[model samples]
Target chain A: MVRWEPGAQERLAAAALELYASRGFEQTTAADVAQSVGLTERTFFRYFADKREVLFAGQDHFQQLFVANVAAAPPEASAMEAVSFALDAAAVFFPDERRPHSRLRQSIIDANPGLHERELLKLARLTEGMAAALRDRGVPEPQATLAAHTGVTVFGVAFRLWVGEHEERPLGAIEADVLRDLQALSPSVR
Target chain B: MVRWEPGAQERLAAAALELYASRGFEQTTAADVAQSVGLTERTFFRYFADKREVLFAGQDHFQQLFVANVAAAPPEASAMEAVSFALDAAAVFFPDERRPHSRLRQSIIDANPGLHERELLKLARLTEGMAAALRDRGVPEPQATLAAHTGVTVFGVAFRLWVGEHEERPLGAIEADVLRDLQALSPSVR
Candidate 1:
């Protein structure tokens, strides 16, 4: 019988990231991660499909957050506003405490092509999910997709700033700054 | 001694796409594509690293076209305008003759996760390349990246319309229509 163990998933994820950082992603094994967490390999498998998935364990939850926030935005909001609302809602997930882990995770991803591709896939999925949510809110096609993709782009730029070595600003501040920058990207401004 | 033959690459690509459409991408092989083109496997490898690459053989040329056009746009043009010029230039590469092949390629990519991921990566590379070109043209940061990515988004939407079974418009027309739609997506416009 499987026993309910609180924080097992978090423990496994932390252990996996630490191992990936110290030993390189390619050299790390499921057994090493499980052992570091004082858990069995079976337990590790229960939390992640493979070592790479440990880095993306929160993707589904994050995607859900984005979709739910977009759906919850006021109907009067424009497509871009709705998308910004979703991104602002998603920003709460990245707190100050997670900054160190996020930094390490980004480095690990940068070092591995497979992980980089998975990250891109996750972002792509989030974009699609956001677009679908906007459509459900009576937003039209092409615009919905365009706005959703733009939201992802905003999030990406903000994320880099939020996690930069010299950046002490909160993710929310970075997001607002990035959104303003996006608005300033008008053709007439040049 | 290997003989240099004209149109060998094009013939291989056409044959590969035809086979992929008829027999499925997974079931098709480089040998089969070569045989279909009456060429040796070595000759096929000379043009593409693998069977999957046959669909993406034009990516490099297209990227060059985008960067060159962005650099060649009028110096006073806005970042978005420069990007639009690049997209308009790249549209020439996808004339009506390539429409059917493009349609089939999109279907194949939609049906396969690997191919879909590859397509996204290709687009990402093009976006980066365009951003660099924009920067080289004295466009500033954030706006440069934003404009380049938005250009890719416009290209994506226009490409879909241009290749849609019911659409009869040329790529350039669709690009203009999509760019107009994007401009209309401002927050004030709803």
Candidate 2:
């Protein structure tokens, strides 16, 4: 049995990303990732099902943060307002320090059709999770799902902008900008 | 050599769906689907890449119809209006006749994680295609993407309602209702 070690998962993830960037996702193996971090393959399997899971490790955390924030929003908040609060709260999970890693991870995913599909699936799950949270908060059908999906769309747009090489603004600010732009899509709002 | 046959694709798709539903997706094969339709396995490959493609055959058609309709909308129409027009136009692709097939297909897809991921990817492609068409119409940044995604979301919700076991309303009407609900999601609109 492999002994438990502190920061092992993070170490593995960082090594996996580096190898994926240099060797390409398709050419990289689980053993290569484990070896890079000086860990056994068994330990790597204990942390991730495979190499792809290393890149997607944060998706569950993102969903949890988004759902918890939406569920905790004040009862008086509108669906959009609640979504906004949740998005802002979730932004804290993605700090500037992680932006470079995100960019590299995105490039790796973009190059691989399989990884891209998994990314889309992850985003879809996040939207569904947020929608369920909205329903729990008493939002009605269709509206809750729509608001949750729109919030996710805004988050996606904001994330792309926020991760740009020159982008210096906080993610919450970028999210606010994208949310305003989304709202402006409504003729009445314009 | 397999001769070109009229409705060969449709025949294969129908056979594939029925087989998938009755025998479970994983238990079925290309040979089984082709044989069920009295066609050779070679003919099946001429139509679909694999068994999974049978259930997703409509995705390309859906994307073409949506993009063409959005592009053909009146120049004076707002982005949202154009999206509404496109969605309405696309509804024609799913008449009452196809509802049973669609419902059956959805159940098979829902039971399989791999198929569900492919479905999400297909929807993402549809959204991207519509967004590109909107941009072609000079809909401007962010708004174009947002409107396209919202249109796809409305399509999804309307589709679920339209395919319900007891749903009797036409797909177009359900789409209009869902679009209205989505619009009302904006604080200014409500």
lDDT of each residue in B1-190, candidate 1, tens digit only: 7899799999998898888888899999999999987899999999899888898877777778878999999999888888878887867888888788788878888888888878888887788898899999898877788888888888887897887888888898888877777777774311
- Candidate 1 C-alpha lDDT tens digits along A44-63: 88889988889887767777
Proportion of native contacts kept per candidate: 0.41, 0.62
* Candidate 2: tens digits of C-alpha lDDT, residues A67-181: 8999998989999889888887867888878788888988899889999888888888888898999999899888989888888998888887887778898887788788778
lDDT for B112 (candidate 2) = 99
Clashing pairs in 2: none
Give every candidate's TM-score on chain A: 0.93, 0.94
Q: For each candidate, what's the DockQ?
A: 0.46, 0.51
Top-scoring candidate (lDDT): 2
Error of 1 at A19 (Å): 2.0
